[model samples]
Target: MTEIEFQKNFSQLQYHLYTSPLPHVSNLHPHQKTIHAFFMLDHLREELQRKNESTLKTVNAKDFNLPEELHVYHSLYPLDQRQEKSIKIFGYPSWVYKSVCSVDGRVYCLRRIEGFRLTNEIAMSTIENWRRIRHANIVSIREAFTTKAFGDHSLVFVYDYHPLSQTLFDKHFSSSSLQANNHPQSGGTGVVVPETVLWSYITQLASAIKTIHSSGLAARMIEPTKILSTNKNRIRINCCGIMDMLTFDGGKNIHHFQQEDLIHFGQLIISLACNSLSSVLNLPKSIDYISRHYSPDFKNVILYLLNKPTPTKSVDKVIAMIGPRILHEINSVHHYNDFLESELSQELENGRLVRLLCKFGFINERPEFDMDPSWSETGDRYLIKLFRDYVFHQVDENGYPVVDMAHVLMCLNKLDAGVDERIMLVSRDEQSCLIVSYKEIKNCIDSAFRDLSRRK
Candidate 1:
């Protein structure tokens, strides 16, 4: 028999492998599983791409009349939505901006304390302590410096930027929450945070305070407005070193400030639980509400923190009291980690197929090789061209375009695996056809790509 005839016979045998039915592996429907997995991977990819775009995104400095540069940072984009409600937490009209660091090409959040002149260099050094203290629930202080880029003596602090993060205040206590509270049709229950989420916040805050106190610093600003809700039930303390700089004295009562941190932490929890900032103002009412709503252990923990200041009343004590609850938080974290890992694994094959498709793009329809009469549509390249049409450019019998993602995925997977399974590829004109194995097609792709690379 001729070599061409032998090849055609072998292709026919390989094609049977695909045509043959296989036993069910599991009870789960294959189509349903494939659809769910593909869609989830696509969503994750799109979200990651969006975050990446936001990170590298630059603003037109001229359009916004923004400063061309502030030391090593540039591309200043205001992170604050409402410039009208300026923050006075740092005892100055503070503005938030998202900027890119020219030195390392990293996006950072810049908290600019407007019109604040640094009289004491030691106050600048206060940020160094905060810079040293790092915790998962803290928005890490990078550096603080005074700049006149905003046409004022602005104290600008650089922090790690978390894209699409909302503050706890905005997430839970914004106009929506207020409107819900004032809704006449409903009772004044207001928007109550879930108990599990509240415990998560408590454990996280306790952990953060422990880190800060251990580093000889205090997180004086622990309110909802200063805490970022980066993800579902995930909170991080923002603007850590601002108060330290603004409230600078030559000598600080570190112990007293540490005690105050405990007080503020208690108030923060009470505020979240009551769903109102005013709840903290009336201590007895807040405690009574907590007693009525939350567990006894929660109320007791709050009472311990809100008690009179003593050297023994530290974050370590808080951690000790709520040690069992901490286990729940860590367990929740591990479960979430597993979920993300599963989601990530689903995208592994998609990434490989994307690379394979890219190779096809480079090798097929080459204008440079078009000059050569025997280039594409002649040999191995012809098979690849037909395979491309089989994979992406399919049509139904009625002449309508067929958009079958499952078919595309299956073909790509087979090609990537370089299986011995064979398929028939038809020419676009329907005048020619070829029976080829995926292994052979994969070889053709690699050969074509290599030739193109060497030519380049």
Candidate 2:
């Protein structure tokens, strides 16, 4: 996406998230607030897709034109044999490419299905059904269009892309260190995934399933390749709408497919635990090993999901077994560039970022006069800009990112994105002066007495 378009979409997302939500309640838990923000964003996505439908009608799939906002990145391809095979199946060759939604500045995956016979009706209907879904743990669909192929029309689906995403299957089983750690007797105790992170993934997947089931949808695509691990060890179910669309003309009941989804999900969970790709073939042994290493509760849950009869198994039951978990880390992006973009946008919208910074004590160490109401507006503004730089930009003489304010804004300066967002500080002087906020500005007019009391 171009800089201008990205800034616009980024600003809109910020307004939705950082603002005091629609009803304006301040006491909501962080979980409630984030869920609400995700809901609003999901609703926004549905609305955009409806508007896109009209424009899509103007072109036939055989001679479709690439509209202005969707720029296809033709040069990107599968980096390895696994990826190539995954995107290409049944002897037909196809691939996924990167693209930018000039409209939203968000990166999207454009997967070309070479030989599918999708009537315009099925494509639109499938997209419409998918668009209504808004779960935070699901990879969202932006748009779907058809293109002309040599023998048929190809259906191309656009999906949200996460930077640095790797399949859960590859994450645990592909690496030597991880492989050795999962089998501790190998004498190479490598980086074992924290128990916290494993539990976190399990609970999040349960949440995603609950959301999907609530929508009366079955996620038939539940294998490891279809699950993506994002920054901060978060796992998201990918391809929410694809399998349903593929079966749109197949005449099978969705519930049948939904039950299959549960089967695969159970397989996926056990695969992670056992660190084996050929999980189903060793079902009995897998259960025995998991029972040996994990708790009785988890073992019971896995048995119910995989070995039990489908007529009796339940997702809610599994979730009840795993119980409740906090989802704050799932919402974060890992790359430094993404951090700066998300943080800078959060700060611009009504000072919640600044409020968070203050709560974390990054803004408490400023010079008294700069924060004092007696200072002229110009002086206060100058100090405020400097303080913003120090908190979000300045580095120490040791060449390390400062560790203040949750290390979010402070750490952004540690990467290349910092050069553009930060004030280009010369040295370490302003780290002592990070205090700044909109609260003080509001105090200048709304409550003089309050400000006077703060000073004392």
Best model per TM-score: 1
> Once model 2 is optimally superposed onto the true structure by TM-score, how far is the C-alpha of residue 235 displaced, in angstroms?
1.0
The lDDT per prediction is 0.81, 0.55
Estimate the TM-score of every prediction: 0.87, 0.54
Across 199-285, the per-residue lDDT of candidate 1 in tens digits comes to 999999999989998888888888889999887889999889888888897436778888999998998888888877777778898
Best candidate per lDDT, number?
1
Off by over 4 Å in 2: 1-83, 87-94, 149-152, 175-194, 250-252, 324-456
How accurate locally is residue 375 in candidate 2, as Cα lDDT from 0 to 100?
38
Cα miss at 63, model 1 (Å)?
5.5
lDDT of 2 at 199: 70
